[model samples]
Target: MWIWFHKLGSPPHFYRTAGRLVPWFGIPALLLLVAGTVGGLAIAPPDYQQGDGFRIIYVHVPSAYISMFGYVAMAVAAAVGLIWRMKVAFAFAAACAPVGAAFTFLALATGSIWGKPMWGVWWDWDGRMTSVLVLFFLYVGVMALRSAFDDASKGDRAAALLAIVGVVNIPIIKFSVDWWNTLHQPATIAKLSAPSITMDMLVWLLAMVVGYTLFFAAVVTMRLRGEVLLRERGARWIRELNAHA
Candidate 1:
C-alpha cells in the first residue's frame, strides 16, 4: 500500500493512469446521461404532486449530490497531499476545483429553475441553499488562491490548506435540510426507508447520479493530466508524453 502511494506520487504514473481512466469513464458518462435525461424527461410519469415541474429533479438532485461529493473528495485529496506530500494528490485536488464549481453552478441553476415552478420563487436564503452557495464560493476561493502565489508549490500548499479548512462545510451542507426547517425537502432517496419514490423515478434518478459521477471522473482525469504536465513540464517523461500527444 505504501509502495502504491509512493508510485502514485510520481507525475508520470499519475498522468498515465488518468489517461487510461478518461475513456473508461467518459463513454459510460455519455451513455448514462443520455439514457437518464431521456427516460426522466419523456418516459417517466410526472409527479402526482408537482406535475411536470418535477422533471428538473433529474438534473438538480444529481448535480447537488455530486457537488457535495466532489468537495469532500477534493478535501480528502488535499489532506493526503498535505500530509503525505504527494504531488499527484495535489493535482487531484487542483483538478477537482473547477469541476466541482461547475456542478455547484448546475445545482444552483437547476434548483432555481425547479423552485420557480414549485415554490414560486427563484432564490432563497434557506439553509441547504445557502450552504451550497457558500460551497460555490469555497471553490472560487481555492481556485483564486492557487493563482495567487508566484511559486506553484507555495500556491499548491496554500490551496491545500484552504481545502482542508473548507471541509467542515460538507457535513453542514449534508444535514442542512434536516437540521433546519427549510423550503427544501428532506432526505427521500438517501433515507432509511426504501426510497419514497417509485421504481420508475428511482431508476431514472439513479441513472442520472451515475452519469454525473462518470462525468466528474472523466473531467477530473482530463484536468489532472493537464495539471501533471504543467507541474512536471521540465521532466523528460513529459517531453516523451508530449511527443506521443
Candidate 2:
C-alpha cells in the first residue's frame, strides 16, 4: 500500500492517473450540476419570505461552499508540500488558488445580487460577507505570491507559507455569522440540530455541493497536470511524453 502510495505521488504516475480520472469526475460533475440546478430552480418551492429569488442558491451556495472547500484543500496541499517536499502537492496547491478565487468571486457576485432584493442594498460590510471577501483576497494573495518570484522553489515555499498562514481566516469566515450580528444567514444543512431547510431543498442542495466538489477535483486535476508539466519540463518523463505526442 505504501509503495503504491509513494508511486502515486510521482509526477509521471500522478499525471497519467489524473488524466484517466478527469473524465470520471468531470462527467458526473456536469450531470449533477445540471440536475441540481434544474431541481433547485424549477422544482423546489419558493421560500414564503423570499419567493422565487431564493432560487439563486442553486449557484450561490455551491460556489460559496466550494470556494471555502478549495482553500482548505489548497492549505492542506501546501502544508504537505512544505513538510514532505512533495512537488505534486505544491503543484496541486498552486492550481487550487485561481479556481478557488474564481468561485469566491462568483459567491460574492451572487450574494450581492441576492442582497439587493433582500437587504434593499447590493453590498454590505457585514461580518459574513466581509470575512468571505477577505477569503477571496487570501486566494489572490497566494497566487500573486507564487508568481512574484523568479525562482520556482522560492515561490513555492513562499506561497505554501502564505497558504498555511491564511488558514486562520477559514474558521473566521465559517463562524462569522454566529460570532457576529450579520445579515447573512447561518448554516442550514451543517447545524448540530436538525437542518433548517426542508428535505426537498436539502436533497438538491447536497447534490449541488457534491457536484461542485467533483467539478473542483476535475478542474484542479487538469490544472495540476499543467503545473506539473511546467515544473517538470526538463524531466525525462516529460521529454518522453512530448516525444510520444
- Identify the candidate with maximal TM-score: 2
- Write model 1 residue lDDT over 97-185, tens digit each, in one string: 99999999999999999888789999999999999999999999999999999999889999999998999999898899899999989
Tens digits of per-residue lDDT for model 2 on 50-108?
A: 99999988889999999999999999999999999999999999999999999999999
Alpha carbon lDDT of residue 144, candidate 1?
99
Show where candidate 2 strays beyond 4 Å: none
lDDT of each candidate versus the true structure: 0.92, 0.93
CA error at residue 130 for candidate 2, angstroms: 0.7
Q: Can you list the residue pairs that collide in candidate 2?
A: none
